[model samples]
Target: MLKIYKTKLDEEKKLLEDELGTLGQVDKKGDWEATPDDKMVTQEVQDEGDMADRSEDYEERSIKLNFLELRLADINRALEKMNGGNYGICEVCKKKIEMDRLEVNPAARTCKEHMDKVV
Candidate 1:
């Protein structure tokens, strides 16, 4: 069962990395930053509308990247727990997480009882 969850988590990590790569690049500190679309425009005359569009696009990418980064962090933490032989245990209550909850989100850090803890 743990092997299955690990596989799923690995696949999810790969997908998140791919999606993040499309919108941004990892920095020296290993944090992902959304690439500005304006950087792609070289010597291209841009009107105010064009500049606004570029800004909007960059903002959208930043939002998306942030979400993906959070999910990736969860997945990474789950993987670390697996490596430490502590997978499927709630971080707050130190109890075995419900199997159904694990099935729904293998990256869960807390049981249903402490679901509001927000890791």
Candidate 2:
């Protein structure tokens, strides 16, 4: 069961990293930020209207990159726990997390009883 969960989470982490890499590169702190792909566009757009459009596109990419980064963090955390022998333990209650819940979300940090709790 743990092997299966780890495989799935590892696959997901790789996929998320690949998706995030398309939008941005990793910083020194390991955080991903959207890299503006429009250096030429910035140079060409002298008008305020064109500048605004470029900014909007950059903002959308930034948001998507941030979301992917968060997911990657969760997946990495789960992997770390797996290595530390605490993979299936709930963060809030410190109990063994339900296998069914782990099956659905291997990155879960809380048990089913504390599902409403936020970290």
Candidate 3:
């Protein structure tokens, strides 16, 4: 069971990192930052419309990158827990998390009963 979850998490981590790579890059601080469009950056902004378009695109990518980063963080945390020999334990109750819930969300931090509190 643990192996299955770890494999799933490893696959998901790769996929998420690949998806994130398309929209942004890791900065010096090891955090993801949205990259501006190459064309927009190289060419001069001729009008307000062009500027707005670039801004909108950057904002959209930034928002998406932020969401992907959060998911990646959770996956990383879960993997760390797995390595620490406490992968399926609930953070809130200090009990073994339900297998069904772990199946649904391998990175779940709390049991079904205490899920809301963490959320």
Candidate 4:
């Protein structure tokens, strides 16, 4: 059972990393940051529409990158817990997390009772 969850987590981690790589790069602090489009240096006057489009695209990528970063953080935490022999335990209640919940979210940090309190 643990092996199954670990495999799922590994697959999810790889997928998230790949998707994140398409939109950004990891920084010196190991945090993902969205890369903006290269600024055009041509002498021709730039259109306002083009500038707005670039800005919108950059904002979208930033939002997506942030979401992926949060998920990656959770997955990493779960992996660390597995290594420490503390995986699948509710952080708030100190009990074994229900298998069903774990199946739904392998990185869950709390049980259903404390699900709302999860970080």
lDDT of 4 by residue, 1-119 (tens): 78998998999999999999998999999999998776723432287787777879889999999999999999999999999999999999999999999999999999999999976
Please report, as a residue range, the 10-residue window in candidate 2 with the lowest summed lDDT.
37-46
Model 1, 49-111: lDDT tens digits are 777778888899999999999999999999999999999999899999999999999999999
Clashes of 4: 0
Worst 10 residues of 4 by lDDT: 36-45
Better of 1 and 2 by TM-score: 1
Please report the TM-score between candidate 3 and the true structure.
0.94
Off by over 4 Å in 2: 40-42
RMSD of each: 1.3, 1.5, 1.1, 1.7
Question: What C-alpha lDDT do the candidate models reach, one value each?
Answer: 0.92, 0.86, 0.92, 0.91
Report the number of clashing residue pairs per model. 0, 0, 0, 0
Tens-digit lDDT track for model 2 on 25-114? Answer: 988997788987556365567677777777888899999998888878888899999999989888888999998998999898889999
Off by more than 4 A, model 1: 38-40
